[model samples]
Target chain A: MGLETSKDPFLTRVKQSEKDTFMQKSVAKAQDAQWDKREAARKELGHWQDWRNLGEQIRQHVIKYLPDYLEEFADNVEKRGGHVYFAKKDTDAVNYITNLAKEKHVQRVVKSKSMVTTEIDLDKALLKIPGMNLMETDLAEFILQEDDWDEPTHIVFPTLHKNRDQIREVFQKLGYEGDNDPTHMARFAREYLRRDFLQADMGITGCNFAIADSGLINLVTNEGNADLTMAIPKTQVVVMGMERLVPSLKEAEVLDNMLSRSAVGQKLTSYCSFSGEQVAGESDGPEDLHVVILDNGRSNALGTPFESVLQCIRCGACLNVCPIYRHIGGHGYGSIYPGPIGAVLSPVLDGYEKFGDLPFASSLCGACTETCPVKIPLHRLLIKHREVMMDKLKTDKAFNKAIMKGIGMGTGDPALFQMAMEFDHSATLPFVSKKPTSVENLYNHEGHITHAPSMAKGWTDVRDAPRPPKHTENFRRWYKDHEAQKGETTDGE
Target chain B: MKVVVFSTCVVDLFFPNVGAAMVEVLERFGCETAMPKKQICCGQPTFNSGYVADSQKTMRNEVDALLSVDADYIVGPSGSCVNMLHEFRMHLADDPEYGPKAEQLASKSYEFTQFLYRVLHVIDAGAELDAKATFHRSCHMTRLLGERVAPFVLLDHVKGLQMIPLPHIENCCGFGGLFSVKEPEISKLMVNEKVDDVVSTGADILIGADQTCLMNIGGRFSRRNLPIKVMHIAEVLNSNVDMSRVRYANEEELAAMAGGRD
Candidate 1:
């Protein structure tokens, strides 16, 4: 998956998705199930707001002192006989992991669900080394792997947009002989993955939260894949975003609760494994352990307005709640992280030249922020991204120039604003299908007329652009005219 | 009680009757209502479109217009506008004076039903209208303002009115202001869903607090030529207009009604 998906006109994708009634129905049903489960879980948790507040506090505290905690975490990991490598960028991360794989002469690697791995394109990176084989151990991820390395639509579900039939087709393509039933498919995949898990030379997993004090990497999974991936493999490698660190086990517990509830509406996942450095006399664990803490532009966010974005736990709750994500689905985001978090993070990690349009994808409804477990202020970050895109980077130069002119004119002169309004009101006449108030007129105008010069193509390409009323008779003007006709003085303080 | 009216740009322009109705309703509740003369737009259109600087201009204009008023409360019939006032105050963070002014403006502003129920403590205005109506809970109001209870409280008490609750009332009617025009197909899909919910209610009329939303739903109602009358809740409550004998028709009736010019 590439950032070009977001560059595709939103209208085209929306129309395509709308046409896919089957996919739409599946999405709607899944959304309903997830929403109900989430509601019930919130109610069961009792004082869900308190939980959210605690989650936010823990994340905030962690982000606030990330550097210190990271150092402490590294120290603890070293003390426990684990090696820690801090990578400032994707190259650094890939090089570190590849070196480890080469040093161990790792022939086969089994991986659990790790978005960070995808972010760095680690699988592709690792495949460059001769005689290296990477296998996805998660059932959904394995399906993705089997399906010619299809990008995940959602961070948590991975293949959520794919129906059971689609999964069956993928399984069939992979030469699986099993009942098309979901349970059977799952069981078949499980039996297949269990063998790979047992024989894998290395286990690579994403850390949900790395506890600073004890040097523990917390991994939450509904499938016992992570446990198996770590258990049987001779060498283990954990890759985590640097921000995925907590001060202690107490914070880890809070985050674990938040992550489970937010991701899949569970009190806790089936497997909540906390692994530290390789210990002596440990029988069922990897002999060598390497923790790669990848910065990957996250360090740039610290002390910025978007610092809160670092607080995201990759729970994918924001994706589940986003209206845009629900409609176009996550593949449209063209990133490992999709939906609201992806919209904010993609442009920051990647340059806006590629993902500038991502920020504009949202309606800024604040739903993501409202539902966010760590209170990342997802919408605010979207806005901040726009600000930076427009003012600082000037990624969309033509659009920004036009908007700046609009800003100047809109703010500089009330007369100019009124004039523009007047022009707009009158301009509606040509495109007006029935009357000014008619939906047909609005839709027609929206589709036909290009209102704002730059980026009008971006908007008008998708939907009817409603013309703003150009009448100078604003509320104030109307009120003045009415009072003048009545010869009555206005009452005010 | 002194109440400042933030006649949202939509009501002030296309649907002036809604504003007139708001004035009458508030007056009946003993509110000394005053429309601030300098207020223009709520800045939401610019703000939501990622034109923060342009939105701030509009916001600054709005703040300048309303800050002088010392009303007990500022009330608007538009949930979107009220929500913008309350929620977008943070955008003014860079401007110290205007930032606090925006917050102060937000604090005084309430969606009409919220002001009526919370501020005026008037559940039933003791006024009556005869119509079977379903309420469309504007998403911004319900989710952003958290004013879910106020509209129900006020509507429950309207004498001679049969209130049928709309199914999926929380779903947006897709009048996301410029969103309807910008993303017409998706907007149509959303509004179509809303219309289905409205039609399923089997009510003769669809009532909402925001004129922009009502206009969007109303336009769809008209386009489809559904026999559903879309009216602002303010118009429904304040009208005292008996609809028992009114026979609804297609283009002819609408033309006649427009010609009658009441």
Candidate 2:
């Protein structure tokens, strides 16, 4: 589906999400459960903040020296008899991976969950090569693969928005004969994926954090599908975002702990598999291991205001706590990523022209900032995006101009400020009604209206436009008259 | 002590009696109140919307107006604006010229109940009110200003008032200035939830520190023909206004005494 086909603009999605009672109930229940579990998990772990601070410091150090880290990471992997490829862009990344599949003449590719691959649309790219059957091993990704053109709702749990009934429908459509029970569903998916794992020529997975010191790529998952994919296949390719690395295994251990707690409130996931090149003594592992470090616009963020965005461990903790995402869900964001981190990262990675509206979608309530384990300052970064969009990029001309004018009038002179205040209530009175039209005029042809205007049509498509107050008694004037009548002295200071 | 009342634009236009009640309540606590004529807005509408530059102009004007008054403290019926005043001081931190002015504004300004409890140290004002009431904790006051206990402290003292607990009291009433109109459906949903909470309390009146929330919730009540009354915290505290002489009930009482009551 085209991005703009929704027609209801960005704010409308928020309104729609707000009114989604089903989604709200699900989100509220999930949040309560997750928060309780998270609290307990944090208390259990002890000194979570200190650990988070260390994780943040490590990530920051890595990002600051990203060039050096990337080189060190690739060198270490190569030294361990693993092939390494650096893809500067999406096309380059796809080209390198596709050429590898072509050279291998791979018939079937079993894939684990990898957002970097999704970012490059690598599955679609792989399909272009003849007879390349790409099967998603992750349960959520598998459901998305079966559903026609459906995107993931969340990074961690891509199918979190979908309930069991929806999953049952997807399974039924995919010709699965099983009960809708979660255990039965898992059994059916497992039985079905086990066959594909056996037949697959190459396995592709995402690296959570490539440890430079150990020359090993770590994959964390609950299902152990990544391990199965890597072990059963003849060749394995790990496509990772360049920033996803730790200098040593010690830092990886710290990060894995933080990631588990923040992502899904787990003490640890079911599997944390580390594999590089298969050793001679190893009984089960991919013989040819190729680690693809994809740097698609991430290099640009280094030393920039958005450097903290790279520290994200894909925990989805920020998304879980986001009020805006709670309502709009993920699909509304029109990207592979969604929620608070997506609101910042999408615009940076995808450019402001396509996703600039994402930053303004938030109320800047700072919930994301408070909940962020790595302390990314998600809300402040969003504001910084707005500043860049309005001042530096000047993407939306009319909106920026209006905002600038509004700011100017508000901050200019005391007399102007007083006069505007005196007139504001009266000026907006025409549209002040219990039932007004979707759009209404504030003044004759001046365009200061009650309804959402053309550029702001996104906001009004789903919300009731507020009717400004229909009275002219500015508080200052009322106070003056009341004080004068009370025989109070006018100028005390 | 001389107290300057920042009556807030919402109360001055849409709900004037909130200002009147504030004055009355302040006098009962033995404080003289004044309203500066040059005051406009705390510039939250622009500031929260990412128009910090524009909001700064209004902030400077507000600082100048409040500074002109030689009052002991600046008290406002709206916690949102007072919170904005505190937020604005931090925003002006880099400027050496406005740094002291921002500090002065921050030190002097207080939300009404906060001023009553913290500044006046009035544990009980010895007022009498006979009705069941539930307090709606405004998000700005609870989360931003951290003034959760002050309102309850004063409300607990009302002679005959039965205070009921409102469910989900900490949730935003969905009256975020631009947020209400900008996303009305969700805004309505949030407010509806708040209304449900108030109705569940079985209280005769719903009280809040901010007029913006009261206006949104109160308007919904009026539109839906809900019987529960909505009042600012100041109006609840200044509940000495006798309703016995008025034959009108249900908004008619309010309309009859509208301009003259204050």
Candidate 3:
């Protein structure tokens, strides 16, 4: 389950998520709350569009010269007594990291939240090693770990789907009896995580952005668990998506300002730490630093129309604004990555065979594009994915293609369109409601179309579609008659 | 001004009153309006569904029809359709024949309210509607066309109409053309949420710039027997008219309106 989080079909997952009213309510509440925070944060910074322009330029410049910067980053890291490994795929990343764990004879591993590691299925791979103990120190990730590794519904707030009661139940499994108060649960998790921090020999954390000029891993978290994870463990591994790097601290600082603001509406996360291989002068830092840059099919988007998708800072702002995500939740996407960004990225990383439906999940609302801090054009990329799948991949159904072909023919020729307009009322009248309804004024004929046959049943099932007026009363004919009357009035004048 | 009306297919068939209201409103502004009979759909049904090659034919037919008339401006009742014309430049940029024509079409085209407020310099349409209403800002119009200010300002000037600020006005109404049918379950959930927001407003009428959105949101309101009437912004502006109060932006007001999106 590298990228794929659930084996359930997309609709099945949607059906399951639909039953979780709590998740839906929570997602809505979180989105509305975050909307104010994010807007206020941007407003505080002033000239948000200009800042977004700067953020986009920095990401675009780095993406344009990605390979050169990666090499520079690797060289600088090596010079600082750090080992660098570029994993082309998830398996490669997992194998390299697991091998390093074996080489170090690691027994206890304390981890911080890293989506890249989850993307590569690193946790399960590490768990396979005999007597290896891994604990997720991030508050949300720890809650998910305790709940039998429930998949994350959101990027920033991983356990957002879980309520205080569910979290209390998860914490009770670790042998503590307490009320469902959030503070009590957090303290319980903190105490439990601190014990692991003292005993842990290795720490794994995700890099928010890797500074290339001066090789350093930047980690931003509201909780200071990442600092503790790096500080307590002798050996540390910093895993990152290959695109998560800037040319220098200057650019990283710009993005850090944006990421914190966009991600959680913070001026800066509680802990914005930059670290590398332990220096001789430093008393407390990792002695052995392993940097793993995982491509994991990110290169598939390179040189494609979708290359801009790599501009994502994983802010999950797209999800917060997405109507579809609000309804179906993250599991409905059936990928480790979800929402608008996931819709574009999952198919790129996984291919159309498994993730084809994700792109069409959106209404192409453009909210994601407007909200994106780095301006990924998430909605446009989703359309691009659809185009690739239907046109190039030829994965769409023949029936849909035939229907679309009919639409093309009907809309393309005015003669055909006129013929359809002539028959519109007569054609749909059969499905029009026989008895007048409360909203009878909405339809001039019997009533609104309460029921329809064929493909239109989808529309009729949920709502009453207005029946088209007769050809005699249609707009074109009406406009013609009105124009004639206007000519007469002008002549009289 | 001679304005060519792009009476979108939805308005031509399902909601012709919206087209009539738009034409009437334009006439009231003292502009000669012409509807290109050859114009039909904007090909969004197929284009957004990913039938790019097939949709191109429909798009080309639209560009040809909209350009058939010699007019100073081309305007439509639907911002969504207007945005489609704007995107014609992107879709047909490779075509040697229609590319320039598509660009020309985009340059002249405007959404109905946008044309009234921005192009014609309208500050008030002098229409009265004795009803409380909330506006649903359709996604394509507000976000894609970037015409957020026009509808609100024009609506604000509608005499005797008390407007309520809709909750989550930024959200889509789940009428993404083919998306409503292709993924109806998700669409249902989204529209249900939209209906709830409108219902919560306690407004008797729902007004939106795009008929497609009004069709979806109003259709659901009818289906639920909610008794909430829906009116397109064009119809709202073309309501009971008081020509004496009709006003246009003066030079100072024009400068203030300059900051609005193109």
Candidate 4:
């Protein structure tokens, strides 16, 4: 339940995901539905690019002075009668929160949807205490919790992989006799979470943006559960990735708009709360507040080429547009973060040794970059990751590196390239199918290679590759002949 | 205009017809075009796969070969390769010798449709094809080259061609050079989805600006035994041409289309 959701090889996970037609269909449906809504929401803003530029500038500025903002934020939280803890490691965060829970003698704890919490494996850590009962308040998180703590396939729609019938079956475990109607099931979940909300002695929520100037913790949610998590408990703890800090409430307000539109295609989330220490006379708010600012490999990206990755607001807009994510879903990444963001970030946060292949998972399509509200250049970052892996880290396999080198040497010399072009047709002749398939060999003059060996097998396995044109009939030769004919006519005229 | 044709490796070897069609189309527009023979590849095959050091030599070779012709503009049939040329300036930014050359090549380079509309000011290539066609917008063209309008505008001008909007045109065809080979499983699934969308458009022919996408999508169509003819945008623009029907953009319209370029 940490950064890695699976220990299986990437290709193995991809193979398993490819077989998940149901999950694939669900993800595609969600993406298609979100596309219209997200586009419409963006277009309604008018000058969306300017807005994006502003959002990007704000994020970049904050990231540039992250430490200063974090210092100001921690100071403000302290001034507001709140305890601030900066945990450099994920374990530091888990240990601190768990120890705090034990010291307070808390028996029940409830949580709202927070990717950082999932990232640090906090739920697993806290549940280890004896007699501890924890409830996930978000409906999707609750569904996952009820389903034996299944990993989220998406950052926003965690349970997107699960169908309504699956949700119904999962809910049936909690003694709900209702059918698979989403609203009814949601109602049943709300009622179930309401019981825990009243009794929960401790509540944990993730920060949307930590407003440094006011020391307010910004929480955005479609559901009001985060409010409940903050409102109902006597002890409150907020977990945030260190990069989630903004300069002020104004910036937070701007990002809140961008996040909601990009994440769920809404103008604003249903509940956008900026809360901190309970007032002296307040009756309902938490008396004790704890804020855990977690670095946990985030600093690995700071001052590096990957620094822009922290600019992400966890909108998951990249996932909705990524063709790779479309086919394989989240688990295919093997990291808690998936899609283009994950492809770039996982290697930085978790090192190339563990998450190197995530970069190659993308088709370098640039959809993620195009769709990013913050304009993170997700696809370019993916390529950067690959460059780092191959040139600096030397994490890629030797065979792959050798092939790339061979390609480089081959392409660098025109003679070698011409030779490759000339030889390709005859070399592939043995593999080319003699009997034509559906269409005549109109385009493929030398026939298509339906099957091949080594690297090309991957291509020929799925589709026939046209053999390079015969050397005598290649484009350059043909062009030279055509130009000669044109020259004859011009000279005669 | 004197233009140099940078026939990408894909077109030079595998799909020469695309390169040929591009030449014919350019000639039809009255632009003098010449092929720089040494411009063999764009280095995307190695560069995008993370072979930065290894690809530098290939990239340098390309910049040298492309700039050797000394033409008014350099153009390519494939947007993906053209975008790679655009990337060369940044990639070679540190190289004091070739940095300026790379930038010059990038500035002059354009994809076929972009060159036709933006540079040549021609909207109609006087092409006609009596069939339904859907265009698979290559990812590099739309996103990297920032050319979403050029291909569509030119396709709209192709007389007798019924253009249907391809469903989910924003998605990639999954031919990320080596990515196609490295992750064929995922690539297969993605390309299959593309094929489904192409079929959904109910078009007999699928056209695209990049041959790489066409090859991947067309390969899938053929592998699945779907008889959808795959074509480059140039081929569609070169088909059944009538010289008298060709049209060009007015000065104001051209200025607007080029974002105020005079």
lDDT tens readout by residue for model 3, A1-493 = 5789987778888889888999999999999999999999989999899989999999999899999999999999999999999999999999999999999999999999999999999999999999999999999999899899899998889888989988988888998699998888888888988999999999999999999998999989988999988887999999999999999889888899999989898888989999998898997879999999999899998998999999888988889899999999988999989999999999999888889899999889899999999989888888888888787778878877777778889999999999988997888867877665545235754457888886778888888888888999899999999999999999999
For model 1, name the residue pairs that clash. A421-A470, A446-A464, A446-A465, A463-B184, A464-B181
**Clash totals in order:** 5, 3, 0, 0
Candidate 2 lDDT over A259-315, as tens digits, reads 898888899999998888788798978888898888888876777989899998899
Score residue A317 of candidate 2 by CA lDDT: 85
Error of 4 at A399 (Å): 2.7
Each prediction's TM-score against the native?
A: 0.87, 0.83, 0.98, 0.98
Over 4 Å off, model 1: A1-16, A393-427, A435-493, B87-89, B93-96, B127-132, B160-170, B173-189, B217-228, B241-262
Q: Candidate 2, A21: how far from true, in Å?
A: 6.0
Which segments of candidate 4 are over 4 A away from where they belong?
Answer: A439-442, B251-256, B260-262
Rank candidates by TM-score, best first. 3, 4, 1, 2
Fnat per candidate, as a fraction, reads 0.09, 0.15, 0.69, 0.80
For candidate 3, give the lDDT of residue A203. 96
Task: Evaluate all candidate structures by whole-model CA lDDT and list the values in order.
Answer: 0.74, 0.75, 0.89, 0.89
Clashes of 2: 3
The native-contact fraction of candidate 2 is 0.15
**Which parts of model 3 have CA positions greater than 4 angstroms off?**
none
Residue pairs in collision within model 3:
none
Of the native A-B interface contacts, what share survives in model 3?
A: 0.69
At residue A406, give the lDDT of candidate 3.
Answer: 82
